[model samples]
Each structure stands twice: as C-alpha cells, then as structure tokens.
Target: MRTVYSEDHRLHDGKHELLEGQFMKVHESPSRADIVIGRVRSAGLGEIIAPQEFGLEPILKVHDEGLVRFLENAWDDWAATGRTFDALPHVWPVPGLSRGALGRRLSDCIDGKLGYYAIDAGTPIMSGTWAAVRASANVALTAQKLVATGEKSAFALCRPPGHHAGSDFYGGYCFLNNAGIAAQAFRDQGARRIAILDVDYHHGNGTQQMFYERGDVLTISLHADPEQEFPYFIGYADEIGAGAGEGYHMNLPLPWGTDWQGYSAALDRAMKRIEQYGAEALIVSLGLDTFEHDPISRFKLAEADYQRLGQRIAWADLPTLFVMEGGYAVEALGVNTVNVLMGFEQR
Candidate 1:
C-alpha cells in the first residue's frame, strides 16, 4: 500500500483544548503521524510521498462553501479580534430555537458562526490551521486517486482525524471530513457504490450525517455507544438512513469494555452488509483508538487484534483505502498501526 502524508500537518498544532469543562492537553498531535510514518518505513510497507494538491474543489464537494470560507479566514478573524489564544466556540443555540432566529443570530456573530459550524470545543483553530487542513484533505485525495487506479489499497495517514467532521460542522479534533470526501470522490469516479467502514473507538457521527440520505455510499460505524462516548447526539442503530439511503447506514454501538471477540463479530456483520450491497470499493476509517492502551478511548483491542482486524478486512476482497483517524497511545501507536497494514499485506 502506498502511504500519502505531508509534513505540513505539523503546522496546526493547538496549545490546548477543553475537555470536561477544564482545559486539557490535545491528544491529537503531529508526533502521532511521525511515529506512524516511521513504522511504515521500518516495516517496508511502501513508499511515502508528499500529498499532491487537489485545490479546494474536491473538498468543496463534501463540505459547505460557507464553512470552508470560515476555516480559511478564521485565523485572521480571530487575530482581528485581538485574541492571542487559539479560538474556540463558547456559545451555541439550544435545541428549541427557531431556525430563522438562530440563523440571524449566528450570521452577525463571529462567535456564533464558530458554534454554528462546530460540534465541539476540542478543536482549536490557530493561525496555521487553514494550510494544514487543506493539506490533510489533499493527502486523503491523493490516496483515493491511487486506489482508484487499481493499486489494491492505499493508506492516507491523515492527522487530526476527520471522521467527526461533517459537511457543515467540525469537531472532535477534525476540521474536514477526509474519509467522507474520499468516499464521495470514489462515487464521482464511476464506482456504483462505496462502503465506509469506520472502526474508530468514538462514533463517526459526522461521516454518518454526511451520507444519511444518500444510497450510493454505505456507512457502517462500530464504536462505543453514544450514551457513553463523545459526539453523543447520534450513532444509534435505529438511524438506518433516510430516503433512498434506507438500510444503507449501520451503527454497531458496543459497550466501553468490548474485546476482540465482540469487536470482530461486529466487523463481520459490517462486511457482510457490504458484500450484500455489492459495493465496488471499500474505505476504512481506520482509527486505532480502540487499542487497549489508548489513553483517551475505551476498548480492549490489543496490538495483535489489529493484525486480525486487517486480515478480516482482506477477506472482503475489495479495493480498500485506509484513512487514518483517532488513536492516542503515543508509544505503541507505530507498532499497533503498522500491524494492521502488515496483516493485510501478508493476507
């Protein structure tokens, strides 16, 4: 598998983020990508190449124009406000507000725009965020282009993981929905159907919302139950897609302490649905946060379990693209991550 990455990802490092009403150190860091890249080289997976620029068009395909514009100008706007700290949204319209009232209130308010377009306060936007967000999207697109040309599979080592960002909202350490954008690109390239298997520890609420009403892309997420995880508003099994997308969206919300036996079974069910749907390509939202040693997530998946995880995905026998997402076990990140790719290669 070819690996797509860029050093520019180091630019968007935020100083801190809010967690549980207190400022906490950001778990998503540049060193996570560095360690994973080192493992890719140590394991001899494939060549690592800088991402080719795809411009803003591909990203605009999946994200809102207003949201994109805000991201590009956010740093300058915050600077103009004379705030030296990283900008974060503090206020949000509650559930009962009228749509027009909320829109009017958010339009004239920079702070409101921040909350309107953001789902959580964990992602802080500093001066250098625009460049890195664009670069990360390009990295995912580069891998998509390679996989589309029959490369068997490719790995997009995206930093500040994107499964949590949707078409119009950003949060959970994500700015742009990398996997969602890639899945849409695959469909635009003539693939009749695509399956996005999001195995992150936290639910990929953004990815699900992006395709909730579409049938061309099948999204299956296996994560901690929303009642107990971040992005707790959605990710229920009953949300089985809306119009033409009925039965296309699947959510397997497991409990916090799930082991490989339980996790693998959920994965098997996800793969079976993909087989039945006859998807032309497979996009795996590969988040290693499910690792037992991860500091920010729950689940008991050991390093060896990742190897099995890859082996099982190989059984599906489709063109696969693994887009990196969340994982916070810094020391074991490389070995645990590379093990998945190695298992797939050997399989």
Candidate 2:
C-alpha cells in the first residue's frame, strides 16, 4: 500500500490538554505519525508520498464553515488577548444555552466561540493547528483519490485524528473530520456507494453524524460502548440512521476490557454488513488505541491481533483507503499500525 504523509503534522504539536479535571500533555502528538511512518519505511510498505493539496473545498463538504473558520483563526484570536498558552475551551454551550439567544452572541467573543465550536476541553488549539489540520485533510484526500482512481489500497496517515469531530464541532483532539471528508471525496469522484468502517477504540461520532442522513455512504463503527467511553454520547446499537438513511448506518459498540476475541466478532459482523451494502469502495478509520497498552483507551487488543484485523478487512474485497485516527501508545503504535497494513497486503 502507498502511504500518504505530511511533514506539516509536526506543526500542530500542543503543550497540554484538559483531561480528567486536570491539564496534561497532549497524547495525540506528532510522534504518533513519526513512529508509524518510520515503521512503514522499515517494513518496506511500498511508496511513501507527500500529500497533494486538496484545499478547503473538499473539507467544507463535511465540516461547517464556522468551525473551519474558527480553527483557521482560533490561535490568533486567542493570542490577541495576550494569552500565549495553547487555546482550550473553558466552557461549553450546553443544550439550553446553545439553543437560546446566548449562543448567537457567543460567536462574537473568542472565549465564547471556543466553547461554541468545541465539544470538549481535550483538544487544544495552537498557532500551527490550522496548517496541520489542513495538511491532515489533504493526506486523507490524497489517499482517497488513489483508491477512487484505481489503486487497490492506500494509507492516509492523518494526525490530530478526526473520528470524534462532527460537522459543526471539534473535540477528541480532532479538528477537520478527515475520514468524513475522504468519504465525501469518494462520492464526489463518482463512487455510487461507499462504506466507512471505523475500528477506533472510541466511537466515530463525527463520521456517523455526517452520513447518518444520507443513504449513499454506509458508516459502520466498532468501538467501546458510548456509555463507557470518551465522547460519552451517541454510538449506540440503535442509532441505525434516520430519514432516508435509516438502516444505512450501524454502530457495534463493544464493552470495555474487550480483547481480540470480542473485537474480531464485531469485525466479522461489520464485514458482513459491507458485503450486504454492495459498497463500491471502503474507508477504514484505522485507530490503534485499542492496543493493550494504550493510556487513555481501555481495550486489550494485542499487537498480533491488528494483523488479523487487517486480514478481515481485506476479505471485504473492495478498493480500500485507511485513514489514521487515534492511537496514543506512541512506543508501540508503529508495530500495531503496520501490522494491520502488512496483514492487509499479505491477505
């Protein structure tokens, strides 16, 4: 598989994020991509190409204009107040406050806008965030282009992982929803039916929300159950889509402490759904945080199991695009991530 990468990912490095009622060093750092790229080279996994600039047009296809504009200017806006630290939201526009007139006025203040556009406090915005996220989206789009144009498979090594971001809100260390953008790119490029299989330890709430009302792109996620995971909302078994998209979306939420046996069973069911969907192409939101040693996530998947995961994905027999999502066990990220690609290639 050819891998699409970008040096710009290093630009978005953040100092700290609010987690568990305390500020801590960000887990979604540049090293995650650094190690994965190193392994791809060491394993000789075909070509490693820089991403082509797809620009904001493709991103706007899935994300809100206000959210994109906020990300693009957030650091500068925050810095204008003389705060040099990374920008993190201190407050959120909860349900009632968000729907009332207060939400409209909040958009004018940088502090208020931070909460207005963000879903959680974990994602910090620094000066280089916009550039990094833009490059990340380009990486995903480049890989999607490869698969849409006839490459058997490609890897979009995106950073500031995007599964948790929705069309109008950003969180879970994600800014632009790369997988959602890529799936839309596939549609724009003429694939009639597309399937996105998210194997992240956390649910892909953003990707699901983007396609939940559309029938063309089938979104399936196998992740830690929402009741027990981060982004503790949505991603239930019953959120099977709405309106024209009813029955088009599927969420197989697994419990905490799930290991290879349980994960593999969910993968089998997801694969079966893709077969039934008759999808013209497939996009895998490849997140290795399910690994046994990952800090923030709670699954127990071992390194070897990733290969089996990849092999199962291969059995789907569609042109595939793997978009990197989350994996914080930086030391072992390379092995677990490459194991999946290696398995897919071998299969």
Candidate 3:
C-alpha cells in the first residue's frame, strides 16, 4: 500500500490533555506517526510521499463552515486573551444546559465559543494547530484520492487521530474526522456508496454522527462498550442510523477484557454487513489502541492478532483506504500498525 504523510503533524503538539479527571501528557503525539512511518520504511512496506494539497472544499464536504472557521482562528482568538498555554475548553453544554441559547458567531466570546465548539478537553489548540489540522486532512485526502482513482489500497498516516471529531465539535485528541473526510471525498468523486469500518478500541462517535442520517456512506465500529469507555454516548447497538440511513449504521460493543476470540466474531459480522451493503469502496478507521499494552484503552489484542485483522479486511476484496486514528502504546504502535499493513499485503 502506498503511504501518504506530512511532517507538519509535529506542529500541533499540545503539552497536556485532560484524561479521566487529571491532566496527563497527550497520548496522541507526533511520535505516534514518526514510529509508524519509520517502521513502514524500515520494513519496506511501500513508497512514502508527502500529501498533496486538496484545499478546504473537500473538508467542508463533511464539516460545518462555522466549525472550520473556529479551528482556523482558534489559536489567535485564544492568544488574544493574554494567556499563553495550550487552549482548552473549561465548560461544555452537556445533558441539559439550554444549548440552543448559544449564538453561532461568538468570535468575541472565545471561552463560550470554545465550549460551544469543543466536545471534550483532551484536544488542545496551540499556535500551529490549524496548519497541522489542515495538513492532516490533506494527508487523508491525498491517500483517499489514490484509492478512489483506482489504486487497490492506500494508507493515510494521519496524526491527531480523527475518529472522535464530529462535524462541528473536536475532542478526543482529534480536530477533524479524517476517515469521515475521506469517505465524503469518495462520494464527491462519484462513488455511489462507501463503507467505513472503525476497529479502534474506542467508539468512533464522530464518524458515526457525520453519517448517521446519510445512507450513501455506511459506518460501522467495534469498540469497548460506551458504558465503560470515554466518549460515553452513541456507540450502542440501538443507534442504527436515522431517516434515509436507517439500516446503514452498526456498532458492536464488546467487554473490556475482550481478546481475539470475542473480537473476531464482531469483525466477521462487520464484514458481512459491508458485503451486504455492496459499497464501491471501504475506509478502515485504522486504530491500534486495542493492543494489550495501550495505556488508556482496554482490550487484549496481541501483535499477531493485527495480522489476522488485516487478513480479514483484505478478504473483502474492495478498494480500501486505511486512515490512521488512535493508538497510544507508543513503543509497540509501529509493530502492531505495520503488522496490519504487512498482513494485508501478504494476504
């Protein structure tokens, strides 16, 4: 598989993020991509290339205009407040806080706007965030274009993992939904239907919301039950899309200690649905956080399991785009991620 990456991913490095209740070092770091890319080269996976600029039009396809503008100027708006640390939202409109009262263009109210636009406190905005965010989207888009135009498959080594970002909100160390953007790009490029399979340890709530009401893009995720994981909403099996997308969405929530035996059944079920959908292409929200050693995530997947996972995905025989998402076991990330890619190639 051809890999698309960018060095600009190093720019959005936030010093800390709120995990659980305490502030901790950001698990989603530039080094995650560094390790993955280094392994790709060392293992002779395939050619590595810089991302080509696709501009904002492709991003706007799956994101809100106001949200895009907020991400663009968020740093400057926060810096104007005279504090110089990473900008994080201190409040949120959760459960029942009268969210309808918030205005759309609150550029003058940075804090309020920050809360309105941000879904969680884990993602922070630094001086170079927007540049890196834009570049990351471009990275996913470039690799997506390669597959959409006829390559068998490609890898989008996106940083600041995106499966947790929604159309108008950013969090879970994600600013934009890279996998969502790529699926939208395929739609804009004329493919009638596409399926996104998220194998991340956490539910891809953002990607699910992006396509929850649209049938053209089918989204499926396998992750720890929301009752026990972060982003504790909307990953249940009951949220099977809405309106035209009624039957297109699926979620297979598993227990915390799940290993290969329990996980493979879900993968088989997900692949069966993708087969039923007959999508023209597939997007795998490739996240290796299910590794046994992941710091924050729970699951018992071993290194060898990733190869089987990739082999199962390859069995579908559709053009695929592997958009990087989350994986926090830094040392083992490269081996597990590359294991999936290598397995796909060998399969």
Candidate 4:
C-alpha cells in the first residue's frame, strides 16, 4: 500500500468547536493526522508519496459549481464584513422556509450564506481552509489514479476529512466528499461498478445522498446509528437506494458502545453484500473514530481491532483505495489507523 500525505493539512486546524453543551476544544485537530502518519512510518506500511496537483476538473465532477464558488470565497467574504472570528452557521432553511423564492438568500451576509450552504455549526471556515481542502481532495484523487493503474491498494491520508459534504452542502468538518469524488472518477475511467465502504464512526450522509439515486455506484456505511449520532437525519437501513438505485445502498447502523465483536459482525455482512454486487473496485472511507478512546464517538474498538478490520477488508479481494475520514483520539489515532493498513498489507 502506498500512502499519500501532505503537511498542509495542519493549516486548517480550528481553534474550538461546539461539543456536548459548550465550546470545548476541537476534537478534529491537526495532531490527529500527525499520529496517523507517525504510525504509518513506525509500522513501515509502505512508501509515502505526495499527491499530484489534480486541478479543479476532477472536483467539479462531483461537487456543485455554486457550492465550490462559495467555499472558495467564503473566507474572503467573511473578512470583508470586518468580522475576524471563525465563521460558523447558526440558521438553516428547513421545512417551511419557502425555497425557490429567493434571489440571493443571504443579505450579502456571510453568516447567512454560511448557514445556507452548511448543515451544522461545528465546521468553521478559516483563512487556509480553501487551500487545505483543495489539497486534501488532490490527495484522494492521486490515490485513485494509482488504484486505476492497477495498484493493489493505496491510502489517501486526507485531512479536514470528507464524507459529510454533498453536491451543494458542507458539514461534519468535511468540505469535499473525497471518497464520493474518487468513486465517480473510477466510473468515468472505465470502471463498470464501484462500491464505497464507509467504516467511519459517523454515517456518510453526504456520500449516501450523492449516489442514492444511481445504480452504477453502491454505497455501504457502518456507523453509529443516526438516532445517537451527529448528522442525525440519514443513514437508516431503510434508506435502500431510490428508483434505479434500489438495492444498491446499504447502511449498518450499529448502536453506541459497540465493541469489535459487534462491529466485525456488521462489517462481515457489508463485505458479503459487496461481493454479491460484484464491484470492480473498492473505496474504503476508513475512519478510526470508532476506537473506544475517541473523544466524541461511542464505539469501543481498540487498536488491535483495526488489524482484524483490515484483514476482513482484504477478504473481499478487490483493488482498494483507503480515504482517511474521522478519528479524534489524538494519541492512539496513528496506531489504530496504521494497524488497519498494515493488517491489510500482511494479509
């Protein structure tokens, strides 16, 4: 497995995030990536490579144009209002909000645009966010290119992790759906079927929404049940794909406090479904936040559990691209993450 990484990830680190009841320290931090990188090196997983500069073409393929434009200009627009704090959204257009009756929803207000385009208030837009986010997408795209050329497996160590952003919205500290974009690129480059296995602690609401109506791409996510998790709107097992996409989507909603025994059982079922689907390539939305030590999550997986996780993934026997997602246990992040990659390698 070749690991793609970049130090620029540290640039987008936020000062604080709202958690529990008050603004505690941000669980999503730069140190999380550092720990993962350290574990990759300490385990001698594989050679680490820098991502290629794949410009905007690949990104525009999956994200909405107006959304991209908003992300690129969000920081500058916020700054122009003479507000120097990190920008977070507070209001949103839910049910009776009267859509399609607008010509610029915000009153030239960055705050309103922030809420309009975002789903939660946790993800903040900082000065270096645009640059870091674009770079993170490049890392995932570069890894996909490697897999397309026949690499058995590749790891995209993306930061400010993606999987929560949809075509026109961004949240869950995700600005771009890296795994979603890669799966689409795989489709564009001759792959007949692509399956995304999102093993993150949180449901890949954005990725599911992105491909929910398409049959060409199959998405399976095993996460903390939406009933007890953030982004608590989607990710139910009942959300089997719509229309032509029926039977192509799967959601294994595990309860909080699920240990490896419980986690692996759901994983086995997810893998079996993928095998039955006969996908040509695999994209793993690898998130270690399920670790018992993870600050914000509730699963009880340990470091060694990742080794088992990796071995099980290898059983699927498909060319895989591991795209980094959530994991907030800063100290154990690397050990848990690299264990999965190394476990796959050893298998």
Q: How many clashing pairs per prediction, in order? A: 0, 0, 0, 0
Off by over 4 Å in 1: 97-105
Clashing pairs in 1: none
lDDT of each: 0.91, 0.92, 0.92, 0.91
Give the poorly placed runs of model 3, Cα more than 4 Å off.
99-107
Q: Looking at model 1, which ten-residue stretch has the lowest summed lDDT?
A: 97-106
> 60-119, model 3: which lDDT tens digit per residue?
988999899999988998899897999999976665664354433343578887888888
TM-score per candidate:
0.97, 0.98, 0.97, 0.97
lDDT of candidate 1 over 1-347, digit per residue (tens): 88999999999898898987889888898889989999999889899989998898888899999899999998888888888889999877666653665343455567878888888889999988999999999999999999999899999999868999999889999999999999989988999899999999999999999999999999999999999888888998899999998889999999999999999999999989999999999999999999998998889999999999999899899999999998999888899888998888874
Compared with the true structure, the alpha-carbon lDDT of candidate 3 equals: 0.92
Per-residue lDDT over 24-77 for candidate 4, one digit per residue giving the tens place of the 0 to 100 score: 667788888898898888888889999899888888988999789899999999
**How would the candidate models be sorted by lDDT, starting from the highest?**
3, 2, 1, 4
The reply for model 4, stretches above 4 Å from the true place, is 101-107
lDDT of 1: 0.91
**The 10-residue segment with the lowest total lDDT in model 3:** 98-107
